[model samples]
Target: MSLFERFEKSFMPNYGTPPVALARGEGSAVWDVDGKRYLDFIGGIAVSSLGHAHPALVEAVSRQVATLAHTSNLFVHEPEILLAEKLLGLLKDPAKIFLANSGTEANEAAYKLALKYGRREGRRYFVAAENGFHGRTIGALSLTGKKAIRDQFGPFPVEVRFVPYGDAEALREEVTGECVAVFLEPTQGEAGVVPPPDGYFQAVREICDSTGALMVADEIQSAIGRTGHWFAHQADGVVPDILTLAKGLGGGLPIGACVGFGEAGTLFAKGDHGSTFGGNPVSCAAALAVLDNVDLEHVQKVAAQLRTGLEAIEHPLLKGVRGRGLWLAAVLTSDVSAAVQKAAADAGFLLNALQPDAVRLAPPLVVTDSEVQSFVDAFPKILTEATP
Candidate 1:
């Protein structure tokens, strides 16, 4: 039996069956079990920041594993401590950190922290943007505004006001004194890498201040120099009270962080919450390697090249491009993004149909200029083949 057959026989059907089984990879490229090579523009859905088989990440993880692997929050590890300090330094604020295993867990941590803050302050409501995605976890799902994934599980106890993304006035209107926090993504990654209008986050900051609501920026997809900044909100020159990160942070290993500022930073008292494998040494070391290697200027350059190349293609299916830096989307004239995605795979490329109208292109940060040009040259033909 093949890999798909094995998967069907043994595994649960949550993810369905994967189209291709990748065996090995090296720097913006991967090979399937059939030995077919493809340019990996999807970058494991924006998780492979330094591309595959990076020397730094491999060495760090291996070395740390040899030294120490799991401490179980029963003891401290140098890598975890160093990783925390480095993240706080990048944030440049007085904040506390909680490490976890995935973006969902990181978001869940922030949600729990906000609830604690709300209990003390007498404000329990939250404000979130429509089409924004937090995670699949119950508490995080309650604040997620997308209707499809959230409909089955909720009637959640938490009251979250749903508003249109990029509309600051909607936030100002919904975030009343009774609202304890507002959850936002600088760029709505799962909603097709959608970025808001200029000065939107600044307006959100002011609104949160006015209502005494904590502003939680979900940077799970937009942070760690992917947007040519350490964090996307930095582009708007605003700081959130709570920030969550994961995805690219571990360079493919599982790790996540919830960073809180000011009062929210100290909201969790002892014996409140903990995860057994949260800050394991190996993952922390891998995160450190990713941080040390991500180059902001290189990200800006590669992004510009890819954007210009995509815009230059004269295809009816492609409407335009949106997003900043390495995080980009090819907006289609028709809702044929799935066709385009399949066409790309057939043409030896890998990307994502993030929405019906948007194909997300999040190549690794280290994607070469030649690779960008190669995709550009092939994209026109790819689109031509995909058109209905």
Candidate 2:
């Protein structure tokens, strides 16, 4: 049996069966086991910000692994400290970080903070927007608004109230002092890269402040220059009390963080929370490499260019394009996003159907103008074949 067959037989049925068995990747491209090369627009679900086989990431990981790989949280490491300091330096003051192994773990740490903070204020409820995708863990899953992901895992701990996304009035009416936190994503990535209404984040920030509730922005998919900003909340001129980050933060390594600002940072006592492999030196080193080599200017310009190019496409079946920067969702007039995804893949490109009506694209930040042109060049043919 092949690797795919072996994987299907050995692994749990949670992810279903993957279509391809990838062998290797370089830059914004990958090759399957069958040697079929593809323009990797999905970017490993937006995690490989600098693209696969980036020299910086490889060198850093190699050096760190040769020096030190795993050290329990018992001892201090330079990479972890430097990463925390560097990340905190970019944000507003009085920020503290809790590291984890993945986005769900980061959200789990934040959830612990909320539960502890709620106990202090005698509150047990958490508020979040509808269609929001936080993570797959139990605590994060509870805050997630998607019914399908949560229907099987019932009886979550926190009482969660789902408000209509981008509706400030609904948030204002729903948020109470008894609420622990109001969670939101600046752009709902998994839900077709939906960008919230103008001033929505600012309004949510105000609501959270006035109601003595913590505002938690889950930027696992939107942070790390994905939206042409260090943090998507920055675009809205709003800052959250707590932020959860993963996906692109480690530049393809498994790392997640729960960052809290001001007194919120002190909520977690020494024994409150911890993770064994949260801040592994190799992961931290790789993340530093990504941050060091990332060209913010280039990422911003390329994303703008892509948006313009995609919008200018004269395809009738293409309804609209939503989102900012490299993060984008192509809205189709008909519910044929899966067909479009397959068509793109068959034509030597890779993309995702985030929803039946929306196909999402999050290419590597290093994707060049030529690559953008190639996708634009090939997109028409792909859509023409997919559209009925």
Candidate 3:
């Protein structure tokens, strides 16, 4: 039996079954089990920040593993301390961090902090934007506003109020004084790279301030230089009380962090929470390498090239392109996103159909100019071939 068939018979049905069975990757390219090479535009759903098998990432992980692979939270390690300091430096704020194993765990930690802070003030309600995705864990899932995934989970553990995204008035109206915190994504990744209106976050910040609610920004897919900024919320020029990060932060390793600022930073007292393998030495080292190697200027240039190329496409099936930096989505005139994804895959390129009409592209930050141009040139042809 083929690898795909073997996977279907053995693995769980959560992800269904992906068509390609990749064996190895280098830079912005990956080879399937059968040795078919494809330009990877998805970047493992924006997790591979420096691209696959980057020399720096490989070396860092190797060196760290040789020295020390992991030390539970009961012990303190230099790599974890260094990573936390570096993250605080990048954030340009004084904050305390709780490390975890993934974005979901980070958000879960943030949620618990918010819950504890709320309980102190007799607050019982939380707020989140409609269509915003936090994570799959219970606390994070309760904050997630997507009904399709949330409905089946059945009666979450918290009372969360949802507001229309980009609508400052609705958010202001919904986030009353009873709200403990408001969770939002600076740019919605799973919802097809949707960015809110300019200054929308500023309004949300103001609302949170007025209502005495903590502002939690889920920058899982938009942080670590993904949007040509250290953090997507930086574009809004506002500071969130709690910032959750993952995805590209570890460069490919599994790591997540919940950073709390000011009073929120002190909300989690000793013995409040802990993680056994959250800040594994090897993962922290890999993250340090990614932070050292990512070129923000080059990433911005590539993002501009992608946006210009997509906007310049004159195909009738193409509608428009949206999103910032390398985190982009191509809107189709029709619901042919699945076909477009398949055609692009067949044409030796890989991207994601975030919706029936939205194709998402979040290539690695180290993706070369030529690689992006190749995708630009092939996009129209893929759309044409996929059109019915």
Candidate 4:
């Protein structure tokens, strides 16, 4: 019986019992309450782009908090403006950004953008992909097609249609001119890190264009250099009318944003949408630190190397590996993902069970080749130990 026991007694059961209680983190590693060190591969679910306790992030947050910690939405902040410009600069198209506190908030804003833009006539429906995870907020959750998350949170907004992932024909058949938006994850992260079929996004873009439906890409988990690109959709050369970002955007801080490009950007007028803590100076500072450190070229090179090393791991149980850059899914032969996660934790490595048969590895952008080599060396044994 300890702090963990007390936590278990008091906390809600939504997340069940978290396996490890991390006390401190530096670079790509962390230590638990029991003083056990671990090489973090999940990067706080791809939130720590510059890794925990990065000096720049720490200094930026510190300076900003000391200067101006909280500002009401009434006043403008320089950091917020700078962050918006930086984020929009990352996109090829001119865009307007709406900041928020998390991924769901970003998606929420995107949903609002769609509705606002579609309200021009009678268009109001949103078409999303089945098994896609947007966010848990009322509006964002409405667009999320996964029944597991949406089942109990019923009585959601109407006019949402879910099509099978990567099925362009299905999307074209389901979404019509009356649909205001088409929402999808560039690569489905929560659904076992499923990558869409080649040329699939192009088809989606075509459908949205043909029907006047705005294409919305939920890059909450796939963007911010996680998949060897500023945004995953860039790799496919397909652009979306709206893009949502969070997770790694603010480095370790909490900040999310919905970016609307070209005509979509003009849909939201002043006073149309707002958030108090969305563009806080401290969070914007942290995000700037992340952007400064994460050079796209360097990340791309490192990601290619990491992928090569992971694929080189010769294990029979490792059925296959997918995804780009540090965002990867090591598919296992069986449904021992829980066991694998436990064993990896015990062995001083951190991983995630995105699905029963998929192990997600999204290490920090700063993770080195040496660390990837170490994980590759240890992976086979860990797989064996986790296997029943």
Candidate 5:
């Protein structure tokens, strides 16, 4: 509470008051300021890929910082080059990478590419999905579809038409010749872990192919083994022309990437766009360690166990679960997700109330089976406490 008081006095009101002031963490648990421990299922909103203070990430970051930290894009660094190569190799495609410090920055870079692509083709429009989230920055927010966060920030710099998500025909109607790109999240993270309809990405690929528009998949929340695949779009076997990644990519360090395939890869010329700490060697090394340590098979196994347990719970407050892999939402029968989140925290677990009715659970990729089972065992009581 003292730390939160200091935070209130020193900080702005953008995030309001943080409920927990964490002191330290290990594996899948965190200790609050008063020395209470809680299972950290939120995982810094899907950024801590290997859980807190993982040895591999710590060792890599330590080793890199003692060597070289920053090159500022004026000179090249080996770690950045190696990280980019590893990403491309994972995709098994030849592409270009622009490293940044956060998800929004990556989207901003991608936004520049879309603008440049439009300049070449004389296209003036972009298409995005309704109820989708890209990021909070203006360029990224321009492509965002949530009216609550976006309404006051516009008039957006870009012209974007938003169609109902998962409605491929509606998307087809929006992406005409004037459209330069179509941006979509394979799984909507902020709109409560909502996955698109079956065959949605395939339809998106077909639409972009037919219209010569670029396909940009914003996989910021669903990438880097979160979905039991290197990228969530791979579940559908669809390839995007441009993709943005962040969250888990840096293993809790700040690193984001904007990747472009084919023409989209070579769109940027001199003075087009750049960042100083975009490819910080320390961050790149941390990301590389994450790539080296993340287990996709483990992600698949635990995700199945967690999902099956969640689905088996019999409670009136439970409406079912939404999403795939570790990114999941417990759909409530009533709008009490916030209450449930509070209750869960009190019961030594952290959960996110993504919306009024959807409580999000995005645990670390390395979360153990016992941790998941413990959460499952405690969830029903937490729900009961919050509901009645």
Candidate 6:
């Protein structure tokens, strides 16, 4: 049986069988089992920040594995401490961190912290935005605004109030004194890379302060230099009380973190929470290398280039482009995003249809100028062929 057929029969149907069975990948490129090379624009859904098999990441992981790999929460390790210190330095704040294994776990840790803080402060409600995705875990999923995915998993642990995204007034209304926390994504990634209006986060911060609610920013997809800035909220000059991060922080390894500022940082007492492999030494070393090797200035330049290139595409089927930095989406004139994605894949370029009208592109930070130009040149034909 074919590999795809075998996967279909054995694996759960949660993620439908992918069209291509990838064999190996290099910088900004991958080859399928049949050896057809394709420019990877999806970047493993914004997880491969340093690209496939990046030398720095490989060496760090290799060296760490050779030295030390796993040390449970029962002990402290040098790499873990260094990674935490590095993240705090980037944050530019006196904050405490809780490490985990994925974005969902990071958000979950943030949720539990908020829950405990709220209980102590006599708050009962939580506020979130519609169409904002936190993660898939039960606690994190409760904060996610998509009804289709979250509806089935009802009877959530907490009572959450959902408001319209990008509406400051609506957020203010929902984040009353009864609300303990307001969870939001600086840039909505799963919702096709939607960005809020200027000063939206500032307004949210103000309301959170007035209502005595904690502002929690879920920077899973937009953080770690994905959007030109280390954290998307930093662009707005706002510091969230609690911030969750993952997806590229480890370059490719599984790692997540929940950073709490000020009093939020100290709310979690010992034994409040813990993880077995959260701060694995090997993953921490890989993350340290990612931080060391990824050039923020170069990433910013590449992001600008990508946005400019996509916006420069003039086609009947192409409506416009949205999003900041390398995290971008080409808004289509019609609902042919899936078709365009398939067409691009057939043409040896991989893309994602985040929505019926949104084609998301989040290439690795290590993508070369030539690779980007190739995508730009192929875009017109991809859209033309996809448009019925």
Number of the top lDDT candidate: 5
Between prediction 3 and prediction 4, the one with superior TM-score is 3
Q: Candidate 5: lDDT of 388?
A: 58
Lowest summed lDDT over 10 consecutive residues: which window, candidate 4?
Answer: 295-304
lDDT of 2 by residue, 156-251 (tens): 976999998889999999998899998898999888899999989989988988989999999999998899888888889987889999999898
The lDDT of model 2 is 0.91
- Candidate 1: tens digits of C-alpha lDDT, residues 136-255: 999999989989999899899789889999998878889888998999999998888888998899999999888899999999989998888999988889989999999999989999
Task: List, in order, the clash count of every candidate structure.
Answer: 0, 0, 0, 0, 0, 0
What is each predicted model's overall lDDT from 0 to 1?
0.93, 0.91, 0.93, 0.89, 0.94, 0.93
lDDT of 5 by residue, 1-388 (tens): 4888999999999999978899999999999988999999999999999999999999999999999988898998899999999999998877899999999999999999999999899999899999999999999999999999999999988799999999999999888888999999999999889998899999999999999999999999999999899999888888899999999999899999999998899999988999999999999999999999999999999999999999999999999998989989999999999899999999999999999999999999999999999999999999999985
RMSD of model 5 against the true structure: 0.8
TM-score: model 6 vs. ground truth: 0.99
lDDT, model 6, position 7 = 100
lDDT of 6 by residue, 94-142 (tens): 9999999999999999999999999999999899999999988899999
Overlapping backbone residue pairs in candidate 6 total: 0
- In angstroms, give how far residue 119 of model 1 lies from its true place: 1.1
* lDDT, candidate 3, 1-388, per-residue tens: 9998999999999999998899999999999988999999999899999999999999999999999998898899999999999999999988988999999999999999999999999999999988999998888999999999998986888799998889999988888888999999999889889999988999999999998999999999999999999899988899999999999999889999999999999998899998999998998998899899989999999999989988999998899998999999999999999999999999999989899999999999999889989999998899999998
Q: Candidate 4, after superposition: displacement of residue 221 in Å?
A: 0.7
Clashing pairs in 1: none
Alpha-carbon deviation at 117 in model 1, angstroms:
0.8
Better of 4 and 5 by TM-score: 5
Q: Give the clashing pairs for model 4.
A: none
